[model samples]
Structures are given as C-alpha cells and as structure tokens.
Target: MMKRYTLMVAGPLVLLGCAGPLTPRDTQQAIRQEVAQAAQPQPAPHAMTDAQAQAALLPPLKLELPKGAAEPAEPRFDLAVNGAPAQDVFMAIVSGTRYSMLVHPEVAGTISANLRNVTVPEAMSAIRELYGYDYTMDGKRIVVRPLTPQTRIFKVNYLAGARVGSSDTRVISGSVSASGTGGASGTTGSGSSQTSLETSKINTTLNSDFWGELKVALETIVGESGKVILSPQSGVVVVRTTPRTMRDVEHFLKATASAVERQVMLEAKILEVQLNDGYQTGINWSVLHNGQHKYSSGANTGNFDLLTGAVSGSLADALGSGLPAAAGTTSGIFGLAFQTKSFAALINFLETQGSVHVLSSPRIAALNNQQAVLKVGTDDFFVTNVSTTSNTGGAGTTTTPSVTLQPFFSGIALDITPQIDEKGRITLHIRPSVSVVTEKIKNIDAGQAGKLTLPLASSAVSETDSVVQVEDGRIVAIGGMMKQSFDDSANRVPGLGRVPLLGYFFGNTSQSSKKSELVILIKPTVIDSQADWQADAEATQARLDKLERQPQTP
Candidate 1:
C-alpha cells in the first residue's frame, strides 16, 4: 500500500519535472488503479524462499545444436548430448523430429541429458528423467508437463500377450448328438441322429491384483469423476483423472515397472580396409634385480579380431610363436573410434594394427536381441546316377544304382543378417545354399545292354552356413569352401611308355592342386554417440565416392 502511494505521487513529480507529460495514457490509468488500491486495506508481500524460487525460476529447455551440421531428412536421430541448458535445446530437437513436442509452463529447469544417439522416444525418455515431468503423444505433438492431480489420461500395458482383449455380444451355439444300435442275432438294426452347435462369447476385464489396486487408488484419488478401465485382450489399463492423481500413479509406475523391465541393445561397425602400414619401432625392456635373482619384462599391445573376439597375430602372439611382430605394419581392416567409450575405443585401437577388411555396411534398424537376415551366396554341382538291372533265372528282377558326385560350378552367393541385443551381443543368421544337378543311366540284365539317359528332376540343395551368437566388438570368422580344382599332364612316347623293361624311357607327369577359402568377417560396434555413427557413415561414403570417381583401365 505504501509503494502504491509512493508510485502515485512519483508519477506526478516526474510530470512536474518534465516540460510535458512523459507518462502515456496507459501509465496514467495504471497510476489511478494504484491510487484506488492504496485506499483499500492490504497485506505486505511475503519474501520468496530458495526452493520456491527454484520452482518459479524453472525455465523451458532449448536444444544446443551442432553449429554447422545439416538437419537430418528423417525425424529419427542418433542424437547425443553431454550438458546443456533446457530453454535453448527443445526447439531444435522438435523441428526436424518426426514427432511434434511441447513443454508445459510447469515443466521448467536445466537438464543434463545423454541420448546416446537414440530415437525420438528414447530421447524423450531421457529428458523426462531430467525433471519429474511426463509426456504423452498420439499422432500429434508430444506434450511434456509436470504431472499433477488435475491432469487426466494415462495408459498401461501388460507384459506380452494379454489374457483379455475386447468385448462384444455373447454367442449361443447349438449342440449335436447321435445314437445307434446293432444286434448280432440276425435281428433288425435301428439308428437315430441329432445335430446341434452352441458357442458363447466370454466378456472379461482386468482381473489381476494390480488391476484391482489401480481401480481402488483411482477411485480414492479422483473421486466419482475419475475412471479406470482394463482391456483383457490387450492387457492395457486406461485411466482418467486429475493431474494430481496422475502424479501419484506416475510415481507408482516408476517404482514398480522397473523390476519387470528388460533392456537390450546392439552395436555394429564395418571393418575398413587398411594397407600394411610400414611402421618401424624399437623394442625396450626393463631389467629388475633383487638380492637373489634378476629378471627382465617386456610388453607390446597389438591385434584384435572383431570376427573372432580373440587377440590373434598380435605382437605378443607373434613373440610367443617365435616371430616378433613389427609395429604399425599390419594388414587388413581398421578405422576411427569417435570417443573413449567401449565400442569406439576398440575401433580406434584396432585401426592402428589389424588385418581385416570391411567390404560394406548395410543400414538397419532393429531392437535389441532381434534377428536380421542376409542372403549372400548360392552354388550348383553336378552328379551322375549309374544303374545296373539283372534278370536271374527266376521271374523277379534286381537293380543296382550308384550316384557319382562331381564338381559342376554353378554360382556363389551369400545371405546373412545379425541381431543385436541390449548387452552388445550379436546373433548372426546366415544361409548359404549349394545347388547340384544329376544325370541318370540305365543298364539292362546280362541278357542285353542298356543305354544312358537324362533323368527327370536332377537337382539337389546343400546348406553349409554356420550360425553363431557373439559378443559385440568381437570378430566372427566363417571359413568353409568345398570347391576345388586339379590338373594333371604327361608328355612322352607311347611305345616307350608301354615297354615294361624299359619303362624308364617314359614321359614325365605334372600335377597341380588348387584350393580356395570363402571367409566372411563381421565386426560390430554398439554405436554410443552420433559422432561415432556419423564417422562410420562418412568413412563408408568417402570410400564409395572415391571408388566411383576412379578411371577404368582397358
């Protein structure tokens, strides 16, 4: 009241000091209101406290964008964040996001969120954790707000398939009955038939103990206006209440749902081709002397097979095999790790020294522990079936058949897909088929000779691919090829070769054997950040572009 009087008197003083009225009409009106308010009895303002101030100072979050990066074409993002203010972060995230988002006035504060390049749903979940705020969305905007008693509308789903789903009219179906009688004394026989069918639909609601608790709690908190419904078939709980009730329910769910939740994820990467880098290094050893004994220690770090997850052909391995490995001189595949995280760290380490090559990486989206399939190769072989039929003195005939398998190269194909689980483990699904053909021949009994003929449907299929589940960042090596080639040649005089006593004058013979291995190397990295994911994409793209621009030689 005193401040209002002071302001009322101060406005006129300001006018008196100035040549003209500086206060606008709106200001004059405001002064009049203050004067009127001053005439009425009023209470003093209360001093604000820290907790209250914190709540009042809660601010809207804003997205801290990557300064010079282009927005993704899709709503999904492999987004990651360390520390940033809320007020400046949300809009940038919402703009290109597939789902619309809104922040309520009550939801205010800075958020320390880490997304790990997760999807929109995952990102929102992380944000929700920053503050005790909840979110809801249908086909439109994701609404974020402080859950309270007055807020309504909530949902819950049962694990797996629900026992009850929907409700409709009950069915009344008829039943069927039949009776028959027979006598063995050559008397008469009698029979009677009756048919009927009956079917009845069963209506159900949430019957679990938790469902009862939820209903009772909703009734208590929301009173008569609130409602809680359970769909048996869907195993979903739909509730309507004030924000206050929702807040309580939210707390309940948070406390209880975690115990039954299971989370899995997968990380993947393609091995980048690297030349044998001619790196030269000197070995250094330290000698330790004790009162009675002296010893030397040496160590070197190198080599990892993502396909096998074993430390193979490293300097240590080489030394153990009596051949010391040279530094920075490994062949095969290698690449960069965007950060110090586990997956990235391993990639970075392997790139420095490894003999693995990544041919390609296909873009895939899958849940943890879900399988993805790939088809890579197919081949064909040839076979011949020889048959001998003999007629003995009796009327019965006997037949002998034999099949000769031969190499008839047809084609090579490969198909494989890997599933990733939350623990960074990978389950690889592979299918490699080999198709072969066969020719048939027929020989009559000893009485007559038979001729060879083409057989109907002379093809066969063979499956040789191995399926394995492995740890993320581990290498899996599949090596098995059954194709082979051989050549034998001899040159000399035929008469000289036929002379047994003088067989030493025969010609010389040359034979050659050829064998090949079909090996597929797979490496996985559970991408933990957009940086690492982007690095993998960029590397793959750069290599592809380079290959495309290369000049072809005749």
Candidate 2:
C-alpha cells in the first residue's frame, strides 16, 4: 500500500513538471502585475541648467582650429564685458600684444559678450555674428569698418572660348528630275514635276557665352548695389558687392569649380563573337551564371552592368534563378553591362560559347563635358566622280578625263562624350562604327582612247549612336551587331578538275555561311583623386611586365 501511494504521488509530480512553471492563472497574474507597475507614476529626471548645456557644447581649451594667415598669434584668454564701448573692447582684446586695432570714424556701437579660452580672431568672429558689426583682418592688425560694399576677385580655371553643338535630321519622300529633247538644228525641252513630301528638324546647343551668363547670374544675386566685371581672356572676375552677397558668390564659385574640373578614365573593348552552331540565336549569358562565377543583376552589391549578361533559355529554368535581362534586344544585337574586377575571367567564360576575337582595346581620359575619340584602321581612296573636258585644236579634238577620288575609312572608330554629376553618375553620348572595305575594278570607255580602268570601293559598315546613363565603374555593352557572309570552296584531283565532263564527277564544291556578332564594352571610371591615376599606371605596368614574360617566336 505504501509503495503504491509513493508511485502515484511521484507520477503526478512528474506530470506537473512537464507542464511548465507558468500555468494559465499564473500567466494572467504576471500580466496583471506588469500592467499595475506600468500604470504607477514615475519620477522625472533632473533638467540641465543653461550653463551645463553651454559647457557640454563648448570646445576644449586646446581646440586646434585652422588659423588663417591674418589670425593674431597670441595666447587664448577669457573675456566678459557688459555694454562696453566697441572701440574699447577691441583695444582691450589686443592689449599688450603685437596686434593693432583700427576703428573707422563712422563705427560707433556698444558690445556685450562673454567668451572663454578663445583666440582673438575667434572672439571677434563670435561677437560679429552675435551683433551687426563688420570687420576685416590684416597681418597683426584688425580693421572695423561700417557695413558697406566690398570688392573681391575670384579666379576661374577655364579656356576662353565658346562651344556649340547641333543635330539635324531630314527626310525627303520624292525625287526632283527634269527631261529635255533636242533636235539637230534646234533644241526643245519639256519638264514635268510630281508632288513631294519634305520634313526637316534641327536642334542647336551653344555653350560659348559662359562669362555673359555668369555675369547675369551674379547681377541677379547682388541686385543694384553690385557690379560684375568678367575678363574671360585672363580667367578673372572682379565683383564689387556687399559682404553678404560676396559670401553667396564664393559658395557658387566653389560648386562650379568642382563640377567643371571633374574627369573620367574610360576603357573600352570591341569584341567579335563567332557563334557555334548550337547558339545561333544569341550568346547564352546564363552559362556564366550557372558556372562557378556569381553574376546577378539584382544583387545588392556593386554595379555589375559592365559584364552585361542576362538569363534566358531552358538552362535558366533548371538553375531556378537568373540575372535580370539587360537593356536592348535579347538576340543578335543587344545591350549588356557588368561591373566586375576581372577582365581575364570574363574572357575565359566567353570562350565556352564561341570563338572570341578582340578587335580593339582602347583607353582614354576625358574631362567633364569633353569628347574623346579612338580610331583604328586604314583609309582607302576610291574613284567617286569623273569629268571629261574637250578642247578644239588645229589638228584634232583633244579630250581629257579627270577622276575624283574619295577616302573611304575602313576600321573601327569610337566617339564618346561624358557628363558627370555630383552623385558620381555618368551620362554618356556614344557613337561606335566598324567598316570593312575592298577594291573592285570599274571599266569606262573613252571615245578614241582604249578602255579606262578605275578602282571602286566596296564596303560593309555597322554603326550606332546612343546616349545612356550609368554609375561610376560600371561597364556598358552594345551587342547584337551581327553580320553574315558566304564563302565558297572546292576540292578535286588536279588533272581531273580541268576535264569538263568528268570534272563534275571528281570535284566537290561547297559553300558555307558564317554569322558573327560584334560586341563593344565600355567602362568609365571617375578620376576623383591622384590615387586613381596611380592605380591605373600600376595596372598598365603590370600588364607590360606580364607580356615581357611570354615567349616570342622569331
């Protein structure tokens, strides 16, 4: 009986422990206690005194302030005065020191200020801000002047010139032609015309009158009492205005200088991708994403647009995730950008899809609002126009033919202009062109002389002009510039190939079509400091060292 009672009691105790310490009634009691405690009144903390707050905000005794050349070189001191003459106060501050104080005849006022452990200039500045006193500092001297106009000269670094840009677009839908008939003895002519549609648009931008615009802006800021004299040739501006207006001018000039002086270093790569048979539609950028490389469009890290790639095709579905599609088309000619540090890695990844060819690698630096161009190739001249002149001579009629040749540029050219803002975003106007030129012979007949031969140029060209905005250090890619070519070839036994009937049986002729895509990648890095230029130089040196290590075949 005893053992049964003990076991029964132990089982109930174990069950209670498993249920936890806080039951429903206990939880409710705890909540009630918390509510009661929160409802009770609480004591407020002590409020700070005026002097305590002042002490908290004041700088320490050894405050290392930037001392201008005009600042007085004397030990700091405390000053407490109540309604004292301004001239006396100034004199008292410089007493026993090498500095001198001069009060203008019109200057008359009473000063009341309390400052501690501050330099003479700091004390004067503090009093000026608190009151409406005007002062100027010379080496070891102070001049108190009445509120009046002041003359200040500002220096601006810019070339003395004007800039102009214009764009024009025109469309004509109809042709203009005239027809005439002539008889042996007399001439008669009849003309007819048809309705034509013509459209014209023109846009012009002028940046030539910078000084004029600046003068107008300054005049508006200073109103009637101010005068602005701009000498663009010398890069100087003289402004006579009130002290308050001068401060505003200083601020405006600072901002303008920073904006105009900014520069960017641009690196570009033009590549040709010959697609493999399986990837004819386009380059499968998903291949890079599925590989060991981590390329994501929506990643929260640095801008990766320099390595423009988008996820597509059935492979992306299998991976369960993909980078967002880039701007422009998904096939042939598309646009992609990436922001990656490794160029070699990107090139290695590209080899999986097709044969890669680097057409051009150009690097240049341009200032804000400046244009840079890079051209690589040759210029060939071909006959474009021909004219014949005849003169009557005693013996016979002499004829002379003149040929006009025009230069055809065959190669790659890139033109780019960059506009950078305070936020480090770059807006670019880019134009890229690629062309291939070949020579063909043209036969022309001269009346008495034999046939005249001239060379004509045959060309295939691809070009695009566009404007885009991107962050600093991001790569911009223009792709899908594709070209198709047909090539013919034959193979046969040397002797059998010449036999007319049997040649067809022995020789094998084949024609193949090739498709290739041109991709241009551009990366612009903002050159904010000397360190950036140093880094670029280091990278160039490293590349040179790497090339020197490679074996050369003589």
lDDT values of the candidates? 0.46, 0.72
Q: lDDT tens digits, residues 1-554, model 2?
A: 99999999999899988896789658756755654454444433876688987888994687688876885456889999999988889889988777789988776688888899988898888987776567889897899875578889999988788666532222345666544443332323233344555543222242546677778888888899889988999999999887667778889888878987899999888888888887676677655554455443432221111123222332223233433343211553334445564566666766776899999999999889876778899999888766555555576656566777899999998887889988998877666788899998988896797898978888887665555566788777666567878999999989998898989888899999887878777889999976687677666655655665789667
Q: Estimate the TM-score for candidate 1.
A: 0.31
lDDT tens digits by residue: candidate 1, 466-506: 34555555544332222344789877777887677676568
RMSD vs true structure, all candidates? 28.3, 26.2
Instruction: Give candidate 1 misplaced runs (Cα > 4 Å).
Output: 1-367, 376-419, 429-452, 455-469, 480-484, 490-509, 527-533, 545-551
Model 1 alpha-carbon miss at residue 282, Å? 33
User: lDDT for model 2, on a 0 to 1 scale?
Assistant: 0.72
